[model samples]
Target: MPFTLVLPDGIQYVGLAFVSTIWLQIGQAVLVMSARKTAGIAYPRLYAEKAEEEASFLARKFNCTQRAHQNTLEQLPAIYTATVLSALKYPVFAASALGLWVIGRILYTSGYMTGEPQKRNTRGGFIGSLCTFALTCTGTYSIISLALAAA
Candidate 1:
């Protein structure tokens, strides 16, 4: 069953971004599960060993999925922080950016699973990372500027 969300007017876009964030997480988890299943990697240690077998189709795909998920994890903290700050200050823009990020991630996962290496560099994953970078930079700057001004 799919989950549903309904937000009030004042926080609508923020709510949407939050929902999208959860969806992104869920999507990544699904990729991990798929990779694990494909590679017969029920154990983490086994996965660690087998994940290096790029010669095998399942292993290669699993490694790709794992890498994508790891990359997302590395970026998620900053993205979430930026989303919160942007939501507080500019809900609509934040939502738009976050929603696009989610879409890009979906494309990234799809491409990676299907052995589309260029997707990370020439496609959706790269575009999503750019969005995350922009938002993180802007949010950090905004916060620091506000702090400096107050001080």
Candidate 2:
């Protein structure tokens, strides 16, 4: 409720954008837990284990979980930027794109948990990537058009 006062424009969509970020963070936490549990190496043991040798079934699953999270981390900034820009310029499209990205990420995570990153590409990871790309392109166009109009 208070957030509306601070962010007057597209409050609902902005809130959804914030929720998307929270979702990503939750995904990261879930992945960390999955990795720890799958690897059968908790705390110090997990930290002390060598990263290079991940031949064990559990280790592989843990790696997949970690990689999925890492991939998300890599794309998070772009997601945030695109969401913000699109929200400001085109609220409806922003919401749709952000929603797709969020949903796709959930599907991607589910596929990743199967211990096959390749499977993720076929499932939702590719779709998520496409959605994120669309967001970025839209945001770029919005910024450029707005800047040109201002000039």
Candidate 3:
């Protein structure tokens, strides 16, 4: 029988960028638990060997492994913004965007691993980034508005 999948190995972080942070955390764990896969993707050693492959081409040929890592690293800023903003303006919207973005990142990462990074498979991730940017702005505006009203 197929067991139901658990969020973050069994617990959910609720709907928010928390999920992406959780995943990025898992990526951290993979650094040791599955170090081979993590490092292989994070830093491709044979750029010339796999210059023709989809996943490695970006890392080896173009020398954009830093960019790949950057994409993973970018997950947090949005999540942090979402968490703080949600706590302020509309918690629900912030929460929802976080969840969506996390799910998007998963799709984005998985797609990048096997498919073309330039394809629609990773679109959700960029959209998630946009969501994060929007949520943060909204929250910041709300905080400023509240301050003005109080003043």
Candidate 4:
């Protein structure tokens, strides 16, 4: 056999981190679905659009949950890209940061579920932002370094 695949050390942790993100996304979706049911929101309505005074508390709560999940979905592309690129040269750090980001998202979602939008700016959000920044920087550096070395 002439073909072989050699994965970087600590790739397992990176794989686990990716799996955790998948589960986190699913969990957030489930929460939003449950909240929609509680709020009596019908299908195809993205959110409760009534005036604040007219909207029921449950409806407001459901909107909050939905927004939290949507926000997570928006961030996933950046998270996945940074994770994969950074893992090529810094698998352990990349995986660690990604793991923290997942935890932070969970906390951010829980806080947002309280129906107080301000609560969404929790420590978890800060942590997640910091981790994303680190990952982006690391991934950029890794790619540039690899390219220069190949030249």
Clashes of each: 0, 0, 3, 0
Q: List the residue pairs that clash in candidate 4.
A: none
lDDT per residue as tens, model 3, 72-147: 6765765675566554656666666667766676556555543355642454557766867877777788678869
- Model 4, position 35, has a per-residue lDDT of 94
Q: Over the stretch 1-151, how does candidate 1's per-residue lDDT look in tens digits?
A: 9997643345687687778878788888888887888777666642435535655777767777877777777877888889766655556777788889988887887787665567666558777987788777767776777688889
Backbone clash total, candidate 4? 0
- Per-model root-mean-square deviation over C-alphas: 6.8, 4.3, 10.5, 1.8
For candidate 4, which ten residues in a row score worst on lDDT? 48-57
The TM-score ranking, best first, is 4, 2, 1, 3
Stretches of candidate 4 off by over 4 Å are: 1-5
Report lDDT (Cα) of residue 138, candidate 4.
Answer: 97
Clashing residue pairs in candidate 1 (N, C-alpha, C atoms within 3 angstroms):
none
Per-residue lDDT of 57-117 in model 4, one digit per residue for the tens? 8888899999999999999999899988999899999999999999999999999888888
Candidate lDDT (C-alpha), each: 0.74, 0.74, 0.54, 0.91
Give the lowest summed-lDDT range of ten residues in model 1. Answer: 45-54
Q: What would you estimate as the lDDT of candidate 4?
A: 0.91
> Which digits, one per residue and each the tens of the lDDT, describe model 2 over residues 23-138?
77786777768677767766654332455335576776776777677777788888888877877677777887878887787778778867777877766887788878888888
* Cα misplacement distance, residue 35 of candidate 1 (Å): 2.2
